[model samples]
Structures are given as C-alpha cells and as structure tokens.
Target: MPDLNWQKSSFSQQASSCLYLAAAPDGTVKLRESDNPDVILTTAPATLGALIRGIKAGEFDHIRTA
Candidate 1:
C-alpha cells in the first residue's frame, strides 16, 4: 500500500481518530479508520458519493441517534 497515499479529513485535529482514504490505480477507493487501519472498506466512487450525500443530508443520523 506504499503507493496508496492515505489522506485524513481536514476536520481531524491533533487527536486524529478520523477516517482515512486512498485510491488505487484501478479507480477503487479504500477507506479505513485511523484507529484501526487494518480494516478497510473498498467501494466505487459512485457509492462513496451517495454515502457522502446521505451523510450531508443527515439520512444516517438515525444510526447515531438510535
């Protein structure tokens, strides 16, 4: 994964227990939490975009609220 330039969220401060992302040459995106880098979530850009949109719309807020 050396070529995978992992990037963290800008919102992450000094204690960066945030999500990290990396893109592969094949166009697949990988996501992982800084606290557990070993576990990765692989998905397409479209799916990721939907997730981001849902997040922005607070559609998944029920998960946290529940």
Candidate 2:
C-alpha cells in the first residue's frame, strides 16, 4: 500500500496514540493507529459505518476481558 493521506481525529491530542482513517482509491476504508502504523486494517465502507454506529449506541460498552 502506498502512502495515504491519513487523517487523525480532532479529539486526539497532538502526540497521543490516535486513530487514523483514509479513503482508498478502490473505495475501501483504511485504518491504522499512530502507535502501530505498519499494521493497517482494510474494510468496506458500510461495515465500518455499522461499527461506528454500534460504537455510538454503546453496543460494545459491555465488552470486557480478563
């Protein structure tokens, strides 16, 4: 994958491990974290939108790990 015009969230601090998103030419969404830039995750726009909606609805709030 070539260098993309990744954009960080406005709520993120200047030097924090922020989430970055970019739209690929192929219409897919690219996601990566500032702490681990090499590991990129690609997904469809609709699926990403659903995930965001779920997040906003607090659907994943109950998730916990031991």
**Winner by TM-score:** 2
Runs with alpha carbons beyond 4 Å of true place in candidate 2: 63-66
Best by lDDT: 2
Superposed model 1: Cα runs more than 4 Å off: 63-66
Instruction: Note the clash tally of each candidate.
Output: 0, 0
Provide the TM-score for each candidate, comma-separated: 0.81, 0.87
TM-score of 1: 0.81
Give candidate 2's whole-model lDDT: 0.91
Candidate 2 residues 23-63, lDDT tens each? 99899999998888888999999999999999999999896
Worst 10 residues of 1 by lDDT: 57-66
Model 1 deviation from the true structure expressed as Cα RMSD, one decimal place: 2.5
